[model samples]
Target: MTNEMDNQLAGVGGAEPAGAPSRQEDRPAEIAPTAPEPDTASSERGKSSPEQHAEDAARTNDAYSRSFPSLSEGDVVQGVVVHIDREGVLVDVGTKSEGIIRRSELSRDTSIPAEEIVSVGEKIDVYVMEAENQDGNLILSKKRADFEKAWERVQEAKEHNRTITAMVTDRVKGGLVVDLGIRGFVPASHVGTGSMKNNLERYVGQSIPLKVIEVDKERRKVVLSNKLALEEDKAHRKAETVASLVPGQTRRGVVRRLTNYGAFVDLGGIDGLLHISEMSWTRINHPSEVLKEGQEIEVVILKLDLDAGRVSLSLRENQPDPWASVADRYHVGDLVTGVVSRLVPFGAFVRLEGGIEGIIPSSELSTKKGTKSGYGIAVDSEVEAKVVDVRPEERRLVLSLKQARREEEQRRERKDVEAYQTQSGGDELRYTIGDAFRAQQQSEEGTDQEEE
Candidate 1:
């Protein structure tokens, strides 16, 4: 059994032992030796130590920091919104991590949702509220950033006497509040060119141009004015208008105000005085009879005082003069009917056609004896008169009522004589004359006999 076991072991060592030559003879011919591989860890150790690798990584981090600037509290940096939610917006400000803008920091209107203020992928400027929070996130603000930038611009505008446009956000007790990236106040008195006593509400939600009057940075107070800007522009235009005005020129104007004596007309930017005497050709007791406020009319530039900035306008000058052709319409000895206009101590005034007034002397007022000065002719009564004198140059006309009555009586007497001659023939007329003479002779004889 030992012998068999040894033979089997020999056979296992060499599978072909039974038929194979020797073990050394059975080996493959021309076998070459192989080279062992190098240890990877040992090679790496030779190139660089772990500490060296750590140093390389640190250097790379520093280069990255130089490329992208670091952020700090209160720093104003530009960023892009990555996401928007009810709480706030996630903004990528090139920091170690994305910045968080809380809902309160989005805008002054806290009631509005954050999504309405900022949208994803929208670039905005943010103020660093905190460099890093407890959760290792940056806290940012959008409203504060906007406020800072607006303050800088406002300060510059105030210094340069510049004008800006803003929307009126709210109405307050003393004035209105406007949003110029920040709160700007406009007092009620400065709201417009005229009085705004109860019209402050009209400016709400309106966007208007304003001039920066005052700015207090520490107090965050800014005062703006709309009236001042308007006044300044008006003054400039008025100067130009005044310079261009010339006497005897016609212009269109709007009635701005009225007084007992005259009306003020706005000729573009400047105001001109329109005297009551120049309102019409005839006469007027008050300016309201001819004009009203805001009435547009054509006026003649009667006079201009450039140095004093005064203008005299006339509306009647633009109309035809009534006295220009008075002589052609009236003449002496012409009988006319007129209305008794006014009474005076010496005589009464009679208004003829075309507003022409004629004077009737007290002596000419009546033809009958024992009569009053006015001859019972009250004011506004109608009467007939003869034109005795006419002086159109002096705007005077003399009338005689007595002469008119005397002429009428003479005409009636002539008419009565004509009627008597027509009723009797020629022979009858002769006989009547003879009889009249005989009656006179008989009367004389009787008287003589009585005397004897």
Candidate 2:
């Protein structure tokens, strides 16, 4: 058997002679060992294998390729304070090395104590100025982190229509700088609708509600407005107050402010004006004399104009009108004693009982003077005056201090004549005596008119 046949017979694992040809007729022709390959088959195998390799390469490349999270130059990161030293604080950033933060960068507010801003073992947010320092440590900052966080919050507030509390820090060119920790701006015009002449510094350290109007994270700017928020709140409360109020309904209020035309009273969340004319039944020289800021008093809702958002109030409405029942107590020609409450250029004001006051005209002030005058009487002096006219319908009282004495004398003379007439009979009275006396006198003078 040939070597090839011997090898094939051994693969069959049968006990057969090597020289025997088991199936020589069934043997197929095979390529020689030194034969060269064809160009087409070689090129086809090369192309097919390369394509398969390219597909595997693409899958491997895709597995390794992914989008990395972006971190800008001024971006900040958060970490925990693991160490505190004389230089500053060291934070563990979960990186290769600890980040060193300077003491100055801990807080923009210089007055704040270092311990208040952060403490050891407390996790906090920080800014990442350098991902790695020369020593391969992450550079972190607390101030920048605070500002970044505040900016994000401001933007969220703007989008979500949320209200934030911020402290007014400083004053700028045309507005105030609010330390939202992000340095927000509030224009001077938006400080208040009325007036804000007060120092803005006084508002420092005070927390106030604010609404975000603008946010610029790139520029690190935030603009806030309190006026809009205040207006909205005021509008809602004003509507409720107007709905609750009705004409003739009285309530207590505090004097909030004053103007030339009236004084504004604070009735809970809303304000109502008590005009100078509505302050009292009598004339008022000024509203301040009767009304002052922070003074509490009862006021009546006279008129409520909701469309205009205005309310008219009166301080005198709660009191009963003394003139309404005045006529029942006194009548015309009645002599009443009162105090001279005030002396004006035109007349003297006399205050009667029950807070009633009447003006005595300048022409009827005094009887002792040749002309009616108030020279001798001063304000607050007690004086007797007679009521010449009492017009309760008009709520007016006309008095005559001078003519009262004359009328009293005339009344006495009439009473004396009536008594004399009643004591003597009618015919035997002074008529007969006077007739005899007059006849003798005429005879003596031959009538005075003829003699003249």
Candidate 3:
């Protein structure tokens, strides 16, 4: 059986046709010399059979045909670091002799010591710079090998929209430089800091998640974005939140960021816009006036625009509605004080506490043309007025400045008359011959005051 197996193997390596091309040309040429095996001595002594001779011959053939792992100029292969010195690193790559990795080829970061980059007896992958240099030793580069591998990984991540971690290395002209095994750039707008003017130095040495936005093997360029990665993750979370969200539902949120128009609130997994107008019943110029970043608060969901992935939230909605109890606070003929918010051709709008506003018509502004309620008051000035009408349904209030002034004047007159009686022994003034003249003058004063 052993002799038959030997014959079968011999047939495979048998001589090709006389005119055919050399069979070894397309394959690796083995250079190791064949030597006689110990078993061949037994055959030569005439004590062994044909099977023993075939076995000896087969053993010699195996030695001659065996080859080292084939390597080329651009191939990457695993090797063990045999030595680390100031000159370079010696790596054994399954070769006749160890390969020579020069100082520049040790790592992408040239400043790193070879020993720091690699240690003796540690195995690493290296690029074949030249299979055989002038010295017949393999020229290898760890830098190039890492670069090639990084490009492949980046391309795959970009294609599949995968997130990868990169260590921030340095701050560059328009962005931050990161080590993604290869040098990668994260643009200022893509750093996820929300502003391009922010300092990027803080991110140095930090490992952050990134999404590859662009990759070019020819140029050896890679562009990544931490912002896009975060947004994409938020999108999925928002989709889930949107599924469970209902209008008028309450949610606990953190104030993530503030803008002139609104504050962005992070509600568990999603961010919702809390518009300035909806922050309070009273008007505010900016969201920061009421909310600060990192503040936690409860918010009400007002509306969701799924196509745009927009969420409308309200902080004021979660609280009591000032208008809901407007009638209970202000009644017709009740005197109130407020700031003059603005003036229009028809009237001036006054804003009371709790954000209630009432309009004073031009006609009702003054008891007469020269009265204090006349429409010349500057905006934001304090004014006293009487609530003439309250319309909670329309969220409108009608006030009369003239009535408030008239009532004030009448109260002062009554106080003066009561004081005079108190000084006169608590009895009403008597009309006499001398008093008749005073009585008639008083009657005329009363009529004129009433007419005014």
Candidate 4:
């Protein structure tokens, strides 16, 4: 049993196989133990390969590029102002880098600082001046964007015959500059309803309505007219006013213009001519004497010519007619005191009241000799006269200065005769001859004194 166990132990401990060489010297030359083959799969699992990393990086970059919008030069985009400085403004246009807008591209005023023109974080439209500049940044312009948008709106306005309101920025030679989102020019002739040859500057800083008359996109020129807009509005209003107007209708109006012949009153947009003759009951040399431009007044419509676009207004018709009741105020054989308004070759005109004049004929100037034909009556002098005839329809009043003086003399003579009779105590014939002789002598003396 022991021998068998020993043999088994030798076999388990790596004893040579049966029939193999028993001697140790018979073993082949021991070769150096070869290192086991490396486990390449386990090593490779420790970290990623360089090519795999490169593929991952490429994918990330492609996704980042797709996140941004495609852009091009001259394209308009909305951007937010990220930063503003003295030199320029930085805007984020959703690209890899923030876009840049130089100070000159912000506004027309180059001297203005960018910070003053734009605020940080404010979103505004921008025009891509350069999609990718040398620095790989978008170059943007605010002014150009505004100009492009403005032109589009302007063109639409012109096509639809629409009116637009714009702020007046500056006055230039022959025109004014207005901001209609873009610079628009209005010629002096089209500035206002009236001439603005020298008054265009008055509209600066004011917002006014205008009509787009002409637009040249290639030239970048736009022509506007405030006058044309006003005229169109006026014409519409005039049509309504003309339709409602009738002869003898009284209306309130504003004085618009004055001329040598008359004043033009704007009666609800319709211009009516108020002649100088119709301005007042009294005579006036000019319309300005009674009416002034821009004054509010009431007038009566005398006549209207719709086809001719003419309106005749009468200011005096709205007032009381002084001559209408002249006959009732004065009658024939009435004595009146008046001022000598004028002296002419034939007679003298005596003014009793406003627009009421009485003429003293040359034949009835005075009672005394050599005083005929109003030789002693001077203009503006006060005198008493008798009304010989009155024609209200003709506006005529004929007076006689001679009759007034003769009546006064007769009254004095009668008073003197009564006093003489009273003193004579009913003796009519006692002093008749003496009285007659005395009167004759007195008359002769008075005549001689008048001659002196």
For candidate 2, the per-residue lDDT at 404 reads 70
Error of 3 at 402 (Å): 2.1
lDDT of 1 by residue, 290-382 (tens): 899999999999988867878999999988877778788878888899999888888899887776678999888776444567856788899
Candidates ranked, most accurate by lDDT first = 4, 3, 1, 2
Candidate 1 error regions (>4 Å): 1-157, 163-172, 175-184, 188-210, 216-220, 333-388, 398-452
- For model 4, residues 138-199, the per-residue Cα lDDT tens digits are 89999999889899999999999888999999999888999988779999899896574458
lDDT of 2 at 25: 38
Q: What are the lDDT figures for the candidates, one per model? A: 0.84, 0.77, 0.84, 0.86
lDDT of 2 by residue, 1-452 (tens): 59999988787676657777764334555632456767985675677577778987898766654332334357666688998866778998665457888888888875677677788999988888887668766677898788778777888999997878888877777778887767789887677552567466666667777888888888877788877777777777766776789899998889999888889998877899899988877666689878888999999999888778688999888877788888998788889988898888878999888867887888887544344356657887998888988888988898887677556555665575677779885656574556545544454344223323
Clashes by residue pair, model 3? none
Clashes of each: 0, 3, 0, 0
Residue 354 of model 3, lDDT score: 88
Tell me the alpha-carbon RMSD of every candidate. Answer: 14.4, 13.0, 16.1, 10.3
Ranking by TM-score: 4, 2, 3, 1
Candidate number with greatest TM-score: 4
TM-score of each: 0.51, 0.57, 0.54, 0.59
- Model 3 CA RMSD to the hidden true structure, in angstroms: 16.1
Candidate 3 residues 1-452, lDDT tens each?
Answer: 99999998996678777787666674556863467567865657876778878988999877763666768899989999999899999999987778999999988679988778999999899999999888787899998998888888999999999999999999998999999888899999998755867778989989988999999878879999988887878888776787898899999889999999999999866889999989998767688889999999999999988688789999988777888999899899889999998788788989998887789988888655544443447788998999999999998999988788767766765676667667888466853456545654575456446645
Report the CA-based lDDT of candidate 4 relative to the real structure.
Answer: 0.86
Better model by lDDT: candidate 3 vs candidate 4: 4
Off by over 4 Å in 2: 1-87, 90-101, 119-123, 128-139, 160-165, 194-211, 251-261, 266-271, 281-283, 293-298, 318-348, 352-355, 359-400, 403-452
